[model samples]
Target: MRRFNLKEFRSERNLTQKQLIAKTGIPNVTITQIENGHKSLSKELRKRIFDAFQVDERLYVA
Candidate 1:
């Protein structure tokens, strides 16, 4: 699976995966997998991620 540059975004936002998990209520493992491109997101998870990062959905899904 192709990875989204989630780590870059997080760095830009000065957030760690642990911080993101805390903010989004996503598990750390799930965040790790998403960052590593080992997992695809469900709609709900995607929404949470978007909310956490304040990013447009198109940026992620495209």
Candidate 2:
């Protein structure tokens, strides 16, 4: 199954969910949902997250 590596990436970056939300301009609930595998991000949000992490979007998708 495909999975998102949000939590892993965030940990590697030493960022908390709140910090990631602020940096990515994503809602806290959305970040939580994504981390918990309850929701997937929209393309735009994914791009924002990738930019915030300074990594390619593929890093988060599996």
Candidate 3:
């Protein structure tokens, strides 16, 4: 599986962490931890994030 580049993804969409929190309903601290490599993504979080991005998950996986 390919690693998701959260920062790059947000940058490509012109999103601030707060904006992503608004869109994904993920907590700011959780997002911060994920970005800093201090936390791993749960499946539910991945689903929420991809849904917020409106992209097919298959595009991100091998």
Candidate 4:
């Protein structure tokens, strides 16, 4: 299965990391780590991201 690459998704939205944090309230460090492959998106944070984008969270799950 393909992992949900947050960086790609964020790029598609034309958003900067800081902008995403501001929009999702998920924190800059968390977004940075996730994007850098140094961290995984927790279930709660995953839900927040998908919900913020108004999409199905499952589609973005690893």
Best by TM-score: 3
Instruction: Give the runs in model 4 whose Cα sits over 4 Å from its true position.
Output: none
Name the 10 consecutive residues with the lowest summed lDDT in model 4: 53-62
What's the TM for model 2?
0.75
| Lowest-sum lDDT 10-residue window in model 1 | 1-10
RMSD of 3: 1.8
TM-score on alpha carbons, each prediction: 0.70, 0.75, 0.88, 0.84
Off by over 4 Å in 1: 1-4, 58-61
* Angstrom error at residue 61, model 1: 4.2
The model with the greatest lDDT is: 3
Candidate 2's C-alpha lDDT? 0.78
- Per residue, candidate 2 scores C-alpha lDDT tens digits across 36-55 of 98997678887888777677
User: What local distance difference test score does each model get?
Assistant: 0.77, 0.78, 0.86, 0.84
For every model shown, the clashing-pair count is 0, 0, 0, 0
- Runs of candidate 3 with Cα error greater than 4 angstroms are none
Pairs that clash in candidate 2? none
Candidate 4 C-alpha lDDT tens digits along 3-56: 778899899999999889987998888899989989988878878888898977
RMSD of each: 3.4, 2.8, 1.8, 1.6
Off by over 4 Å in 2: 1-4, 58-62
